[model samples]
Target: MKMKKFLAVISAALLVISTLSACSMSGSVEVETEFKVEEVTEKEGTTTVAGKTFVVKTNDGSGLNLRSGAGTEYDVITTIADGHTVQIINQQGSWANVTYGTYTGWVNMDYLNETTTVAPIVETTAPSGATSSPENPDTQSGGYLYSYAGFNPAEITINDSSWNLTLLNRHYTLPEGYVPQLSEAVRGSGVYLDYRVAPHYQEMYDAALQDGITLTPNSGYRSYQTQKTNFENKINYYVSQGYDRVTATQNASRVVLLPGTSEHNAGFAMDIGWVTEDFENSPAFAWLMENAQDYGFILRYPESEDKQAITEIIYEPWHWRYVGVDAAKEIKASGQVLEEYLGVR
Candidate 1:
């Protein structure tokens, strides 16, 4: 039975490979083959392959384990330390086979970067302006906003037509039986809640009201198909406007969560700000800063000089994510990014 199961798994893998045989990059055909259980014979001397680099923001204890092949450890090299540069000879799975001098080994490809040097960490001398988390008192937790490592890509949903997982940007309609009630004073108020944050968004609205700030919802749910079209539309619009693919992708990436990688998919994130510059700068924004966590929300992105660590494509003062009141309050008081407050790191 074990042999039969193994063969079946192998067959399924082969079928997937055959289906993807046409996919290639840079004139090189990428063959989809079954995950081979066999070991790769290590070649003596050294060989080089093209790759990219990235700097390490934190120390992941798993030392670069030198493997002769994928998933097989022949040796462990200890000399390589955090913040050291490595030349990647090849990439397999999530591990990058890297070489530095005589040492050749595998490192978690997640931490590797095309840039080796990270900007030095600067301590904020000013008193923290944000709410504090009750979860941990030693330090504020806003560090998650500073590092992409805090992001859990696995939580992101990527479906054929819809993605409803964490960290996904999706299109949805307000669930049946859901209706938003506007306070009489807030009606005709220019401020609108991005519908991407909907019925689940009431918690935030109520919390803001408690602080004497009347916020309104503008946009909410979007379908996956809508996201796909929006993505292509942005690509076309940017290219039409003379923006290259890279810049356009970057610009679009900020506002439009790549179909499968948006937090808006959770139906728990909203963008809020005042009706005018004066309103935006007024006590409403300040109230959000002081009390948003009470409603299970956190400011998604905050301004910082260090841009390399935070992967946020765009900066928005109004965007907030719901993580439940307890977590939100803890995160707010802790002063950590949602990613860190969630312990994604």
Candidate 2:
């Protein structure tokens, strides 16, 4: 009876060991299977399986513009070069917006491929400060860090609260640090504008002379002290004319500026008072309008009520500011105010 019990115990022990071994094997198999599935899923997610790049394939020329957005009225950021590469940025109906540089604009889907893809990270920052132009910064005097930045006859920088743009002959380029300080300056005084708008303004001066209109740049850059005096004088004049602070300040802002808000502070823009009177209605104005684009200048305040209101200043028809040849030509051809031409408005 004792021998039988011992053999039965041994058999039970063997069965227990076998059951444990089977469970361990099953667990290992499950772990391997799960790992394989996850690996496959991860591979599928990152796989570059379906995309392709399409070159400009047609000889039939068409008018195409790279808009700031998907619509026609949106700003035209840049025109795509014939051989330039564009990564398809998905499609909305018949149009596909592709990104080039810091701008995203629409292109016809027929000209691109649905299967093509480009994973370019688009930068939406404007061309200023940290987001400087693509060309080498050292190559040309492009940055706003020169000895003179943001000085106008008027003292305040003409930019609004946003400081994104300024009012000059055209769109004056104010970089990050050269923004206007308004709240601090009292409104009764003329507003000064400090912005480096020179490179563009100089181009216009040269262009005007080319057209037999000797536009003398009477004032190019002015010191802050000079702007302060100009503002105070305007305020005093207005106060003497029976105008209150608000009215006097507004009127002063038209032709003068509160110290520190003037464009003269930038040392770029200038007041080009003609040798003779009737400069705006003279040949000088006509010549500037005709040939300023070739030399890179634009009459800052266009003679339109709507545009003048946008500029928040009276039309100084003689004042032409330079923006650069490419931008100037675009502005002149468009016949739109600087704000409109720049699409800032």
Candidate 3:
């Protein structure tokens, strides 16, 4: 009986050891299975969360314009070269918010082709003459800085005879011999303007007269030749003041636009009261600032430094452009310069 009990106890001990070993093996398998599943899940999440990459594809090779806003009507932040890679951040209609090098802005998705290959991160510095600040950073709507380097006006010439909304600036100019139909801006004032602008100017002049202000049209409707003479005279005046030819020309551009670049050449802009800064102090300017938008006129060059940077022109309180009543009101309400409103700068 003692021998049988010993054998039975040995058998029970073996059974207990086997059961514990099985449980330990099962736990080990479960832990290994869970780690494999977690590793796979993490790898999948990383791929899924990463932004898709794209390459710029342009047929003209002029590069794609990265804009401050989603549409072409928005200000262009920079130009991305063809075949450059960008990572899309978001999409709106046909536009995609993208990051190229150190720059971030919106680009047309139609010009981008999806790429599975990831681009290596590259840091870049802003172009010389670009304005940047810590608060504004360097490459976005709130921070992107525009420089006047390497700009060729001939590349952006506009030949269209759009009386109201045609853009003329250092970056954009009228074609040679471009002219508009003209009439007197104010009866007997001898200042001519585009026929579309004359009626509005007459109404604005009449309204100002009702308010006891004489809103005289001092200058308007300059032909290309007239604009050229005016620009040369300005350059000569600056040269007489001891400036080099290059510097004088630059300085002259701030006051008198270069030939076809002047709004006066387009026959839709008018200079009222005086063309100097003293015009800002006059009641005529104040009245125009308050009521000109109602008659489809807007102060062309504003006094803001940002606006000056965009326009590349000095503040001119007396200069006004006719953009139709709706556009005038919108531009005034937005407090943006014509370049920003029209998105051509």
Candidate number of the best TM-score: 3
* Residue lDDT tens for model 1, 1-345: 999999999998897766675454335565645566776765432333333444433356533433434454432322343455665545666666654322245666666557743322112122234222233322435332111212223332234232212333222222223223222222443332334334335655666777677655432333333344444444333433454544544445544555434444334455454211232475667777777766656766665533213435444555666565776777667766654544442
Number of colliding residue pairs in each model: 31, 45, 0
Task: State each model's CA lDDT, in order.
Answer: 0.46, 0.48, 0.71
**Relative to the unseen true structure, what is the C-alpha lDDT of residue 324 in candidate 2, on a scale of 0 to 100?**
55
Worst lDDT 10-window in candidate 1:
144-153
- Candidate 3 lDDT over 1-345, as tens digits, reads 999999998997898778768879787543222222234333311223125789889989877887756789865544666776787655666677665542356788889888887865322222344332223212324211211212246424434464478788876777768888899999997788988889999999999999999998867887776676555555444444455544555656776677778888888898786444666998998899899999999999998898999988878887899989989999999999888898877
Q: Per-residue lDDT tens digits of candidate 2, residues 128-238?
A: 232122222223343322112122232234344433235543134333245333221112223222333443444455555565666555444445554544544453344
Q: How big is the positional error of residue 315 in model 3, measured in Å on the Cα after superposition?
A: 0.6
Over 4 Å off in model 1, which ranges?
1-200, 273-282, 343-345
Q: How high is the lDDT of residue 238 in model 3? A: 46
Worst 10 residues of 2 by lDDT: 183-192
Clashing pairs in 3: none
